[model samples]
Target: MAKPLNLLELIPKRIAKWEEVEGLVVILKPKFSHPWMREHLLPRLKKPYYRVKLDETGSSVWRLCDGQRTVEEIGKILSQNFGEKIEPLYERLSYFFQMLERNRFLNLTQKDQSSGQ
Candidate 1:
């Protein structure tokens, strides 16, 4: 049997700071550590890092990560926002989320049990 989808896992949310720089909105976490710190310094440096550029759609999705909403919720919202072109919206949003996770722009957290109000 195929494994059941974990709703929380599928649409995890995280807190991130957003900035508009050079005509692009950048998303980043304030606590990410540098890879070269431990080897170069006696005490590892824990400076803030900003490395991801948020496109229009990405900026929209990033704005929705206000400690609320699930992946499914965001997907539905995007679907409605895009109307007949929902598939592309869904695909883009999913791709953006995956990229953010991979680049450590934010840390994914399980959705709370309570449905968003």
Candidate 2:
């Protein structure tokens, strides 16, 4: 997993399909964290779910992780929509993505690491 970046220039991808369940974003957890969980006991048992409830601000930011927009771009949109500056914008956004990434919700994508922009 990527560490909490000092900047938010990387692209991100959702790990799996998620759905809004009663206003919460929920993802299905595979039956097994280890292969043995599936093979030893719950081979046929249904998978459980992981739900993340987002407040207004988090929901707005979460909705923007469409696997295409760079985190910086999303920060700009947040600035425009909210009509105020998000100082240390990239750092905050990077932390958000890093949390999600660590929890297996998403991952960042970067093609050009040398771009200092």
Off by over 4 Å in 1: 1-11, 21-24, 28-32, 35-51, 114-117
lDDT of 2 by residue, 12-90 (tens): 7788557776665555555456767657766565554444666555666777888778887888898787754555666
Give the Å error, residue 97, model 2. Answer: 0.9
Listing every candidate in turn, what is its Cα RMSD in Å to the true structure after a full C-alpha superposition?
Answer: 5.1, 4.9
Runs in model 2 lying further than 4 Å from the true structure: 1-6, 22-24, 27-32, 38-47, 85-88, 112-117
Candidate 1 lDDT over 1-117, as tens digits, reads: 986655434545555566877666786554435656534652454554545786655666676665567777777776676677546665676677777778666555664558643
Candidate 1 global lDDT:
0.62
Report every candidate's CA lDDT. Answer: 0.62, 0.69
Residue 87 accuracy (lDDT) in model 2:
58
Clash count per candidate: 0, 0
